[model samples]
Target: MSTVLQPGPARRKAARIAVLSGIASVAVALAGCGDSGTPDASQPTPEASAGPSAAAAELVVQDPWVKAADDGMTAVFGVLVNDTTADVTITSVTTDISPVELHEMAMSDGAMVMREKDGGIVVPAGGSHTLEPGGDHIMLMDIARPVQPGDEIALTLTFADGATSEFTAVAKPFAGAEESYDPSTEMDHG
Candidate 1:
């Protein structure tokens, strides 16, 4: 009988399996090292270069008006809306008429009265405040010129945060004049 000269079939099969296992181990090791290499050319950088990082808040003035007065003195009123993430304080007011002074209305001895307020108005974030006749208002004293209907006056409002908003005040007749003059109403007599 002829003897088997080479390795048996089972031994050859085992050798082939060992070679395949070695190749698989090498492939796994290479995959583990891939993370440490330089980044691929197709990938983006770490810093994202787009859009505004911080946006400023907006201040909106609504229905601004100035009332006619004598002795170069007048009253300015409006509604101020703060639509931002920061607190706003009206530090100073400037106008062509004159320096604006903050004023408040109060009752003295059961009589309506008005007085000067040194401190300015504070508007909270995402909130609104009002300056109107018979309330908190801006007093324009020593006007350079006369104001009439359809006249536009520029009022620069300076904020504590160093931001300024310039608003135009339209000259109009006093608000609620009819109600204020009606004889049948309590406000009319007061």
Candidate 2:
């Protein structure tokens, strides 16, 4: 009878398994170390990127900013670009400050007139609405802390379709707004 060699050990199989496990671990580590993708600055963040109560919309907020103010109030300026084929309406604005309102400035009686935007600002299809000083913008009022240059202001823009977009406006010292209108005409939007 031919001499048969008994199975010596499971060492070979165990070694193969160990090598596979090491490869899997290295793969996982590399995946975790990969670089995060870059984002487009023009568009608003997705729901996952933004927090709860935020949804995606066609409007893009570009170069948003809040001018520095002494203490009482300030304004956020930016351009709202609606890239959709249909018109988009921005219903309201909210911020970290106590009171925030959507405002519009226009020349009414040969003088600059500013007031709270009643219904909402409408952005035509494939058009852009500029929220600038002496124009349409978000008014941040009743702020206890003085807004200084390089500060950041958090704000949310609500739409008529129930979608909300969040953005942060950087504070900069601008001078054009001082001569735009009389500061005493500000009224309560309550």
Candidate 3:
């Protein structure tokens, strides 16, 4: 004989409420915590070394980082701010971590699908494009080395106008990403 355990209406309501409350808590935390703080002495991130390029005076990069990955693929998250009159295209990204490409994630058929992005990412004039988890992001294909917490990864970004800016992204452990994306991957912003 088998037993049928059915949840009562009250029990179901309680479960739903619990789930919603948890979600709300996380939303609040992510919103309130702000950008990943500056890198520690064990590792230094881009925020430590440089400012916006002289050529792209109006272009700014902020809160750049990659999730910790020992190997395989990973992703980078950050914000591109463009206050200039000309739209700047991120033509290419180079890093010691791995070969990188512009990628986008979208919902397809009730599941998340990721694909290579064409034409690169554009920081619109007077606006910005954000690269975050579960959205448009930088894919570091096949992380060639051990990228662990308290490590720094060098990144170089080249723009459409033949301008380039170097970045240093700190490898930090992140939670809650496995719920929306592969745990092996990566974050972003305004």
Candidate 4:
């Protein structure tokens, strides 16, 4: 009732060739594709924007990155550049991971506190706004999952004119900027 079958030498060779051919095909398909697994912090992301509008075309996020976090929340830092002769105001930020907020550090009771930015961030005409630790940043609240180093997070910035720009930011470990103004929740940065 049982059958014992073995492939012949030619059949075995053909099977090996098929497997190798599939691997080669995959390699060929992935050739020249971006995302090398390890992101280069110094270089801008190849796929920076998804669908840039007229206003978004003149805007660029340079060297964008996110702080690694196991849970809770994380922040994104980058250099927002405005190439046009008019100032660009980012009204809001949206992402798939969690709620996003434009946050800035302020002196509250002799301490630096993180709070929501009321009027959002503005990149001056032909200038740039640097989002760094303990400064202006894009805050990701209540992350659904862990954001480890080398991970990519996509975010969309809505300008005051209703134009939007999307970009992906790589995650890296950071040890600073752990203070959160909300006493009900703890922030994760390092």
For each candidate, what TM-score against the reference? Answer: 0.59, 0.65, 0.62, 0.66
Per-residue lDDT value at 179 in model 1: 20
Lowest summed lDDT over 10 consecutive residues: which window, candidate 3? 181-190
lDDT of each residue in 82-140, candidate 3, tens digit only: 87666778878999758888888765566667877778888877788898877888888
| TM-score, prediction 4 | 0.66
Tens digits of per-residue lDDT, candidate 4, 78-164, equal 999988667788999999998898988777766666788889898888899999987999998889999999999999999987888
Question: Per-residue lDDT for 51-162 in model 1, tens only?
Answer: 1111112777788988854335677888988776665778778997776777766676786656666567876677888998778787785677777877888988877666
Best by TM-score: 4
Q: lDDT of all the models against the reference?
A: 0.69, 0.75, 0.74, 0.82
Model 3 off-target regions past 4 Å?
1-58, 179-190
- Spell out the clash pairs found in candidate 1: none
Most lDDT-accurate candidate: 4
Residue 140 error, candidate 3, Å: 0.7
Error of 2 at 13 (Å): 21
**TM-score of candidate 2 relative to the true fold:** 0.65
Clashes of 2: 0
lDDT-based ranking, best first?
4, 2, 3, 1
Model 1 TM-score, 2 decimals: 0.59
